[model samples]
Target: MTFLWRISETNADGLIGTYSRSNGLDRFELRRGKRIEVNEAMPTVRFDGRTRDLLAFDCLSNTAAPLVSQRMAQALRDSCAQDVQLVPARIEAADGVLDGWSLLNATATVRAINHRKSVYTMVPGTQAIMSFRHLEYLEGCLGEHQLARDAEYLGHLLVSDSLAQALSDFAGASFERPEEAYYETMSRRWNSANDAR
Candidate 1:
């Protein structure tokens, strides 16, 4: 499936890219009762991983939303029967730019009924978030290898200056320095919730 990146004015800066699943459907054609043409040239990223694939995109929110991270953590925890713990994760970016960024990582064993573990890492950017995730099933799973490769590819993209430049170029806006305090507060809340569980 091909993913299209479109710019929307949902944020104050009005330059945010949203990733959506495209089925090559044309709104105009459907309205006019015309034959829809499929354009295969659209940029598409194939995910080949053992588990669900993680996609990256710039959200329109002013700051990183805690609900997004919380939901992700909850999903990972729910996937396994054992209690899953999510703590601050250290990210060693090849470019070293992510050294000061807040990262969250978690891993949990699959339910007793299944064999394997689920792993996920999230890197929140000023206006975007990149997640690397995979499930280690017995005998391996389809898309696990692809997920790893995509995570690496996306990790580089997150730390690269070109990503910001591309966003600026496309949105006609500048990247705002992320509010570290906000993210820290969110992290504390998440950790506190984990502790209470």
Candidate 2:
């Protein structure tokens, strides 16, 4: 999807050129919704401020096709000398065990615990409070699991490098799993409850 970035506003000193800055005072009063169409080429870079930074008078539109990520990497490299790499992945199936939230909740709980204990060592006096706060972010996942009683769940899908690493490491950690049948039933009930809404 193409993202359009229109100029909102700029510094009063005119360091950055925006829509209003480009226009000059004219004799004829230009009311709102006045048809200001361009018959010829428009002014490009107007260096008004001390910094002499190039600013535009009007909005610029750009279009792109599907090879967006590749183009983005090339643009970044062109702008700066930095190495860019991308990793892609796909899930073949859900394994027919856990519904979405069942697996996600388990994963998030494990992660929050590890983060609270290993990554960030909170003082015992504050550990309980911090842990609760951290767990709150995972509420959606927990609620989802509670709703999807018995369906097999699979997620923690890898979208980015950092997320993939976090999920893989989190999965390596352990948690107490209920008996298979009980877990399935609970998951189904929870999923049904949520779906009703």
Candidate 3:
């Protein structure tokens, strides 16, 4: 299925939530403890027959390109500190906006909708702030497998000063100290996924 990387925000109570997606009405809720954590990973998709149809949207698809939505693209913009043009690398777009984009990675899921999405760019200037994997899909779109790969990739990206700055800009707050609480959540998800594997 199609997937993207994302960063999400939660209310104080951490119940009601929103994600980045093309669909305007897709608001998601997190369980008791399912907030996005720093240096963590989560799945983007599951390979169930019910969702096999979603594979049609995979960026690697040889048929008609998938249709990414404007709503989701807007979410990516909101997640960033400022909008900059993404470079062409693993990313493929003629001149369209970040609105209708999806990733070709194998770890995407089509479960809950995701919001606040953006195409990952390895540009020198932007990379100094945020080190994104292939792309950023926010909210709730991935399943389990995709989450792990994303976390692994994101953790590596965080090692850079620029990535830190980019995350700060996207979150609109300073993340000076590492997120201890987020680490715990990430550890659990990783261990669980590893054990299952």
Per-residue lDDT of 141 in model 3: 32
Which 10 consecutive residues of model 3 have the lowest summed lDDT? 25-34
Error of 1 at 187 (Å): 3.5
lDDT comparison, 1 vs 3, better candidate: 3
Candidate 1 residue spans exceeding 4 A from truth? 1-149, 152-159, 169-185, 188-197
Each model's total of backbone clashes: 6, 20, 31
Candidate 3, residue 150: how far the Cα is off, in Å: 13
Over 1-197, each residue of candidate 1 has an lDDT whose tens digit, in order, gives: 11112223333342222222253432222222112344442312122211111212122221111111333444434442132223321222222211111112211111110123434344555433343233222232212111111122221101113333433433212333223323545678889999999
Highest lDDT scorer = 3
CA RMSD per model (angstroms)? 19.9, 24.3, 18.5
lDDT by residue (tens digit), candidate 3, 107-190:
222333121343233547553325422233344333333222234233211112333343333321222222333354567888
Clashing pairs in 1: 48-143, 49-142, 49-143, 49-144, 50-143, 50-144
Name the lDDT of candidate 3: 0.27
